[model samples]
Target chain A: MAEHPSSPIPGEKPRWLDQPRNVTKVVWALVAVCALLFLSDVLYEKHPTFAVEYLFGFYAIYGFIGSVGLVLAAKWMRTILMREEDYYDRDR
Target chain B: MTAIAELAMPISPGLIVILGGLLVPFLTAGIARVYVLLLSAATLVYVLGLPSGEHAAFTFMDLDLQLLRVDKLSTIFGTIFLIALFLGNLYAWHERDRMQRTAAQIYAGSAIAAAYVGDLVSLFVFWELTAIASVFLIWAAGTDRSFRAGMRYLIIQVGSGVILLAGVLFHVHETGSITFGHIGLGSIGGTLILLAFGIKCAFPLLHNWLQDSYPEATVTGTVILSAFTTKLAVYALARSYAGTEMLIWIGATMTAFPIFYAVIENDLRRVLAYSLNNQLGFMVVGVGIGTELALNGTAAHAFSHILYKALLFMSIGAVLFRTGTCKGSELGGLYKTMPWTTGFCIVGAASISAFPLFSGFISKSMILSAAGEEGHFITWAILLFASAGVFHHSGIKVPFFAFFAHDSGRRPKEAPWNMLLAMAVTAGLCIGIGIWPEPLYAMLPFPVDYVPYTAVHVITQLQLLLFAALAFTFLMRTGLYPPELRSTNLDIDWIYRRALPAIIRGLGSGIGVVWDSLIGGGRMLVSATIDGAARNFGPYGLIGRTVRVGNGVAWVATLLLVTLLIAYSAG
Candidate 1:
């Protein structure tokens, strides 16, 4: 009689579902760009010859790749290492 | 050898400062306060006016030696140390606590003395004096936390001095000269001395004490604590051990590690402390490379780092004074209330982040360029990464979280006038040095040749900034970046803060159990021995009989026979 009762007891949908679809799309697009940049950097063995040349390009490409890598790594790490903010407080 | 001789004055103006430091505590509070300020100011002026190449020496008892030498390097450090003391005294002037005032004076005096020391022994004495005097500032904060931090700080600092002493003794024994010079890193004594400097410089893991202690110090106490100790170490390193290759890597690690902790730390002052560690890393790397340009970078970076770091701490101290807490989790939207303090903090942030036309941009670029020129590709890359990380934590995170983030609904009044004035003076120095680095460069140990405004350096730096900003924006938009929430960050210091104490307590209890058993066994043994002795020697026992003359005669006859036999054998 109550097979689906827990599904909609009140307004209990996860918060992520509430955001606009465009936000998710943009995030994916950024992720894709970061992956593409990383692969390109690995394949290309050359750096710009002049210090001033391609400065913005190199930074943007590499910085984006690094930031994305950091985010994913941190997310992975949190599953193992993350503790409650007050973990030390109880002992105190 | 005696090319430039001066009158061997026993009580020079330098000694006057040292003596004044000792005498200040005995004076009335009002007079002591004025006298300390005046004395420090006079010392600053005297140091500034000292001829660049002047060297003086004095000896006592034909064994104790004293050398007070003033050169470009010593003068720059000594002068700044005096200025720092003056400002620090002014900041703490309202406190009637004699211990704080006297310790502050001694700390400053010793640092100034250390700056001008020309031999290993003199440097060692002044070095330990600095360690002893500065701990009082930490203790003056008058909290259990401050007490413990001060104790740890003192131990490490004094440990450094002890190491330095051992090194000096060995060096003197080997080289037969105690004169301080560019003793290359070729021997054990030299390496020990380098380690001593490394500890003070807060190289890598040795850095936690700085962050751990500086925040726990009294509000005014923290300002004085910031300037002298580590900078003196840097000066010593630059003077003695420049161009050591390991320093480059150690410096790089120092630059990189602190940013993560700073990024997540809840306490603002603690965050600044971590930033200070990161900034010192840049200076150390420069010293390690030891090119003329790199050394200039190290000196310039140190000069600017001291100013900006002090300014940042002063701003945070102002906030802490108004509000009881300096935790980022508990603070926001203070700009509307304490605009002056916020503005000053922003100047410090911009200068530290190396924004165009800021002090950091001019000085830090020198080191990065030096890294590139030296063909240290990995170090150059890491430093570039660290530059962005600095922007993330110190430049953007500090000011934004404290002043511009969502209002935490706590409205505090602006900082007092004196605090604002201090911030203003420091802010001025930050700007002054950035706009015209020639003065700072000229005062460096080596000649300055590289210009900071080259097109390649500027463009590359700008691109790095833009990309870092873009990355930050991207993360913020995506909600993937970790938000600045109220939290405590774990760092290498956690080892001492949590693990060390726990381990000590654990080991203590474990040992206590074994000790308790051992004591019990010993007591049992003692009781048994006493009982046996009682049974044997009491009136009722066999040995209790009065043997007297017969037993004595037998024992003496045996002894004499053995002695005669040994003598006959020798013959």
Candidate 2:
């Protein structure tokens, strides 16, 4: 497999996305949104069907933990499950 | 006059499409596409016009059969299926592959008909028809990989049909009623039927066929394939196995596990397949709850899920169509070239992520709420976790890796106009449903009681999804997120695909060895017996020697004397 190319597309002016700073800006914006959402927990009236909903930023913490755990678990799973690209094709 | 008038019968929309599809190959390429679209549109109108309750009822072998059952549940499934058919045909308008077109039409038709059939026997007929018809779409790619994947897919699909038939037989014998109604796992028939549905629903271990095959199908073929088989199973489960307690855990497992696989998956299409499995989980949970609200959630979710899932598949298929690669490792910076597709892909991503104003948010929340309402605390918690996991993998990873990751510098043309239109329409449905789920909800099997856009609901959902996004961003920034690699991951299908075949080969060789040893031993025994006989009976032996003339005479006299003596003694 070819390694991912980092160079800008030839003969074309660099788009806004081509700059690393723009990506960082997007990430920072995402962080800000996350913070605002976490803080906005107080503004909404709560409907506590389960006890967990009463926790401050419960959804946020659960979501963050779940995602990180999933990624890490998947990364570990790759060690056992992953194989050469042509694994199935080789026997054929 | 009476006999002549009695010969007329109303046709099911499925049969209409199937017959129309059969006529596709005779038409020229350009005309066939238009004809299929028109025929599908006409069928959709016909389906819309079909009245509620059974109409095309008949009796055979003293058992009643309803070829067309139009209830609220079936109608919604049928409507969405027809819509999918029309959109699929329109999207695939550019292709001249008549076989794929025909297969797709029949497949869609069978699924629609299967949804509406009110009897188990009729359902089985359409079920197998769907299985038989849809394999060609996979095979349409015309590659060795596609061919093999198609075969595996066919075997599993048809295997499901076989199990369903067996269940139907037992069920008919036990109850003496062929009505396809709520069949809990109380009897062998019901359990068998659930297994059959589970196989198609991709319930955990039975799931690998979808991941194995859909990515192998042709571009348009994948789009068509995505809409039917699993959703049909969801319909079947909703019809029969509703309220089966076991399905709660089954559904929760279904919802939770696939996100991991989707996370590391390289093939964008396969990632969507995993996401499809996860989405089916929500529907399964709805069915398991079996309350009015929960079933409505199932129906609503199925409807919206089909559209968004198709949109995602279409986007990836378009990428595959244009760039000749769907591997995330090979695709990036495509937005610079195919901005429309990038935008459409994000819509699909956001919808699947269940953002505030997307289809999934409206539908999936109802199921979660159902779980919470019923005090299914563990399942509710699992679903909540699954929702965030979904956003991480499908919502972020798919669009990020494909369109906005590190530049691969491979600029391809934008998707065809037809494809863009199809995506645009499906995306519209996704957003429309999210905004106004009332129309969709009114079509449900029960009165709509759940509201999706409450402030608490909206803010909490946003909190869940955004934090998940933040986690993804953190992982990416930290270099902890798994890099997209060109490799195959083993799943449950590896047992059948690799392990079973290897075991069979081993057994065959073992049997060969045993047979060879037996034959060798038998041959040795026969040769040894012949050698012993030859040594005794040949010229050098005692009896048939050449010099036996004189010796034989003397021996004969001696023997005669001894015989006489013995006779005398006896007397």
Using lDDT as the measure, which candidate wins? 2
Q: What is the lDDT of residue B243 in candidate 1?
A: 93
Model 2 per-residue lDDT tens digits across residues B241-328: 8888888899999999888899889999999999999999999999999888899989999999999999999999999999999999
TM-score of 1: 0.80
Candidate 2 segments whose C-alpha is farther than 4 A from its true place: A1-6, B1-10, B542-544, B548-571
Q: How many residue pairs clash in each candidate?
A: 0, 0
List, residue by residue over B1-571, the lDDT tens digit for candidate 1.
2433454432234465777888877888888878888998887777666665535666654534545677777777777777777777766666678888888888877887887777788888888998898899899888877898899899899999999988887887788888777876888789889889888888887887898789989898899899989999999988998898888999999887777667656788888888888888888899899998898888888878888888888888988888888888777767767999999999999899887778999989889889978888788877877787777678767786687554655568998877887788889888888788888888877787878875545555555555565576566666676655565555566787678989999999999999999999999999999999889997876677566798879878999999999999999
**lDDT of model 1 at residue B191?**
83
What interface root-mean-square deviation (Å) does model 2 yield? 3.3
| Tens-digit lDDT track of model 2 for A5-88 | 244656788877676777778888989989999999989789799988899999999999998999999999999999998999
